[model samples]
Target: MTTIVHNWSMIASGLLTTLVISVTAYAGALVLGSLLAVCRVSPLPPLRLLAATWVTVATNVPVLCSMILLGLGIPRLGVHITLLWAAVVAVVFSGSGYVCEAVRSGINTVSKGQVEAARALGMPFGLIVRAVVLPQALAQAIQPLVNILIACLIGSSLAAAIGVPELTNVTRALNNQSGEAVLMFLLSGLVYLAIAYLATRVGSLLERRLTRSQGAAR
Candidate 1:
């Protein structure tokens, strides 16, 4: 208790850092993942193959391994990547794969008849996707996307291994200094639980609003 009180500022800073990284990484993942999802469903065989390969490799590789490669290996090759950006890139890379899968699944759920009708009307592929497919798919993808956001938040803690000083890293340092490992970890866990709960609630609210809007549109 005393330890946490004394280190409140540090803990708050670390929490803020964690949020920044998670949100940034999740945003990047959404953009990259959406592109990947499009490619995965592209008419071009090569594009589909490339996107599939990326999803396979990125999903299979551990986030820590990616981090180490970006943070340590790249620097040895004479290219500079700060630990912060390395962490962000690594999370974005891995998270993008999951996001791609979620979006692809949502895309799959879109009615094939609608697509066929759009094609029959001579709509270009891009216009059909943008005007007829993506909006509906994205609505269905909300929960999965939210889950990815939460995963990004948890995964941000791994950045501590590369010395990013996120919440878990700060907690670890405090534990080492105060020797109150139980209390320190417990406090951090509670914070995480709270944040995750809020994320879930927000997802639910958004899902309900979309559902109501869709129902009314029908």
Candidate 2:
């Protein structure tokens, strides 16, 4: 308790770093994932194949492995990469695969009849996707995407291995210094739990609002 109080600033800094990394990575993942979802559903076979390969490789690779490869390997190749950005990119790369699949599942849930009707009405593919498909698909995808966001938050801890000094990293350092591993880890866990719970509540609220809106539109 004394140690935590004394190191409050460090904890706060670490928490901020964790939030920044998670939010940045999740944002990147959302954009990339949405594109991948579109590519998976594209008429172009090559695009579909490429997206499929990306999803397969990204999803199968461990987050730590990706981080090590990007954080260390890229630097060795004569390219400058900050540890922060490396962690963000690694998390984004891994998280995007799950986000893509979640969105693709949402896309699948959209009614084929509606798509056919749009086509019959002479709507271009892009227009149909934008005006009709995506809105509905995104509504269904909110929960899954929220789940991925929480996953990203937890996965941010792995950045510690690459010396990113996120929450877990700072907590470990504090433990090493103060010899209060249990208290340090417990506090860190509580912080994570609190953030995750808040995210879940927000996601639920958004899901309900979207559901009500969709119901009323029907």
Candidate 3:
């Protein structure tokens, strides 16, 4: 109790770091993944090759190795970055690979008629995606994206290895300082579970709202 009270601020700092990394990583992953997902379906062979190669490389490589290479080695090539940024790179890279696949799967479910209708209406490719395709794909894939977010949250803990001082790192430090191992772990676990729960609930609500809107339209 005493140690927890004394070290609360330190723990909070770590939690804040974790939150920052997770949110940035999730956002970056969504944008990168969505683009790659689109590319994976593009007509151009070169674009398809680029998207395929990116997904393969990102998925195959160990995230830690990717982090070290991008965060540390890239600096030698004049791309200086902090550890947090490094973790962001790794998370987004890995996350986008998974998300690209998921988004592509969702895209596959879109009817050919829908795209044909959009083209017949003289809608540009970009406008069609913004007004129709993205919304549909996102509706179908939101659950998987939320699940990926959960995985990314857990993975962010690994950033502590490179000295990011996220929630897990603070827990470790507090554990060593206080010797209240069980309670400390329980607290940290609950925090993680709470975060995951909130994300899941938000995704579920969005899905339900979309379903209802579709029903209303019909």
- The weakest ten consecutive residues by lDDT in model 3 span 63-72
Residue 44 lDDT in model 2? 95
Error of 2 at 167 (Å): 0.4
TM-score of model 1 (CA atoms)? 0.97
Candidate 2 TM-score, C-alpha based:
0.97
lDDT of 2 by residue, 168-204 (tens): 9999999999999999999999999999999999999
Candidate 1 Cα lDDT to native: 0.94
Q: Per-residue lDDT for 1-218 in model 3, tens only?
A: 78778888998999999999999998999999999998998878999999999999888887778777876788899988998999988999999998999899888888889999999999988787778787788889989999999988988988877778899989988898888899888999999999999999999999999989989998
Which segments of candidate 3 are over 4 A away from where they belong?
A: 76-78
Worst 10 residues of 1 by lDDT: 129-138
In the order shown, the candidates' Cα RMSDs to the true structure are 1.0, 1.0, 1.5
Candidate 2 least-lDDT 10 residues: 129-138
Question: Candidate 1: misplaced stretches above 4 Å?
Answer: none
Candidate order by decreasing lDDT: 2, 1, 3
